[model samples]
Target: MTHFVTKRAPAVALLIALLLLPACAGQEAAQPTIAPTTGAAAATAADTVADAATVATPLPATVPAATPLPTATLAPDPATVEAAASPAAPTAAATRTGANYVLSLPREAAVPADWLMNPPPDFQTRSPGPGDTYRFACLELPARSTGLATVGYRSLEGLPSVAIEYAVYPSATEAGAALADMRQAASDCIEFTIGEGDNAIQAAFAPLDFPAHGDDSFAMALTTSGPTTGDLLTHVIKIQRGHVVIGISHAAAASGPLPDTALTESLAQLAVEQIDALTGE
Candidate 1:
């Protein structure tokens, strides 16, 4: 953050010099005096004339320097600065502090201390999927009217990580319909594939029972195996609240099928409460 500072002029210094000038002028005008009319006096008078000629002369009046007014400086807006720095890559701090796009969503303070929010794009291990391709580029969410905001948290002690993404549509109806389509896609997207040829990764998703919130909701557990990580599981809960669609993804090594843990359920419940508080419902 940059601080605003004002530059000041030397007006007081000038004023002090002006006040002391009169006494100095009197000393400059002093001249030696001598009595005349005698021979001895003539020599003294000649000396006085020489002394008077040596007396210093007074200088001309100087113009007072003009004093400038303090200039006002404005600090840069935090959002504008972050946008300029990296629109595609936002920090966890920025995600929580600068994400005012959704007024009714969870604030940064609501996030758990054990979780690290908004990992940088480079820090993420997963590649974009087919569903991700339709993000802001498709008919479901028109380019200008759609918005995406995400907050990610990784366990400070382990490999478990969770991310909450909000996708905003033009209206509640559009958002609701899109979420319905997503639930159907999630149901049918079992045993899917990513990458190409030998580098391909096999993935699967199974529906899970979760307490409903918002206008509509669905839960799923996704299992994927890759060349490097062996196998991993992600528990996902999708919720549609008004014109916004919220997707929370919780991932860890597939120790079984990513059963709904207390941490996962608590995080989801917190999001639901934050959404409700935000909408004043």
Candidate 2:
């Protein structure tokens, strides 16, 4: 009876051990599987944690609104705009004083030695006003001028003379307009008479082609006939430079030949010198 009991006990122990092995395996399979956190997986996990943290945090009671930046825009240059707006401004030569543009006696060496600056007392004062009867009115300073300087040369023999008139205006446009008016006056006074009786003289005008100078220039010839004065001829040349205008005239007895080329060339050179002085060149 003792031997039988021992054998039964061994069989029961074996069965118990088999049942415990299966239970332990099942428990391990039911537990969750853990993966290694690395690479993209690690980054994803960090981002998820940050998102949860942000959701958990509370913002201020009044959150400020974002402001948008202004759009870029192009603008025109200021100098270009100013130049376009102010067209009346004169050239660089216009900076000179009125006297600096006039020819001085020292520089008149090109003129004949016998000729002298003996302008009549009323020469410059001869500028015509309303109802004025001045004989050389058209040759005087134009109206609306700001300043003037005049010099006249007369031959000791009293047959030929030279006169130079310089004037400045408010602007180059005004100077140009004045030049045009002088041209019109010369045209209108072509056949006019000066004085009366024996002293009376009949004058005729004709255009003369002269070399261009300064910004603009024109020349005309005037022939006058009188009983005492005989026949006399005058050549007038007008020029515009910046805001300044110049009129140069050479008058002589019509009996003599036209002024020599030397005289006319010298006068043109004088004009150029005056312009150069104004321009500071």
Candidate 3:
């Protein structure tokens, strides 16, 4: 989880707090890597029981609540990676109107000064969307030619969050075997625990029946919390040409039935749609 920004209500206070954190200063992607943002904060990230799948009103056409993505600082040095990964990708600055957002595509070669720099070095290029602003996920995954990275994120206001990673290798066999280490990490470092989820790591990856979205190839497991309280929320997205991974997390002040699923799914789809809209040229 790159950095944690705690939005106040709609996604400002905590979002700014996340942007102000020392851990997130300057971001870079001078080479092919899994530099994820975790973006800024905006929605109320507290956890609450959802009212079941209620028909959601599509986000306003005018994206209203996105934070200013920092500039990309494609630098090297593992220690400096955070500085390079904290900013946005190469593209035009996105706009907002109540929560809606949009961003430009990478194929244009015309990137905005404020948008995070992309094509970090060895990584391939892909457009985000044809617009100026868009929602996205910023993630930090294992750094290897091949391996599985346990990923999951949710946005504020109880939106749905989806996390899946892809690290290609020489062959499918190599890729499959290479992920063993990652499995160990997931086994050793990550664990699942139902109820209000808020810990150093997600107690469990929810959505028990997690489906492989379109080309999503791996057999995934899912889980969800009953409810809880939170005071902060973080918006983040990670994009790398062929594959784009996005997710979010909330830091509640209390524990109970709070609404956060809405924010999670909203952010997830926002970032995913941007990827789908992108041109992998």
lDDT of each: 0.49, 0.52, 0.29
Instruction: Give per-residue CA lDDT, model 1, range 46-91, as digits (tens).
Output: 1111224565788769967889999999999999998899634322
Which digits, one per residue and each the tens of the lDDT, describe model 3 over residues 119-147?
11122222222222211112223232321
- Which one wins on lDDT? 2
lDDT string for model 2 (110-210, tens) is 67887645341111211323432212323433354555555555555443566566656667897788777667767776677654576465767798878
* Reference-based TM-score, model 3: 0.29
- Per-model TM-score on C-alpha atoms: 0.53, 0.55, 0.29
Candidate 2, clashing residue pairs?
none
Full-model lDDT, candidate 2: 0.52
On the 0 to 100 scale, the lDDT of residue 112 in model 3 is 22
Where does model 2 exceed 4 Å of error?
1-98, 101-106, 120-142, 196-198, 279-281
> Quick one: ranking by TM-score, best first?
2, 1, 3
lDDT of 3: 0.29
* Residue 88 lDDT (model 2): 43
Candidate 1 local Cα displacement, residue 13, angstroms: 66
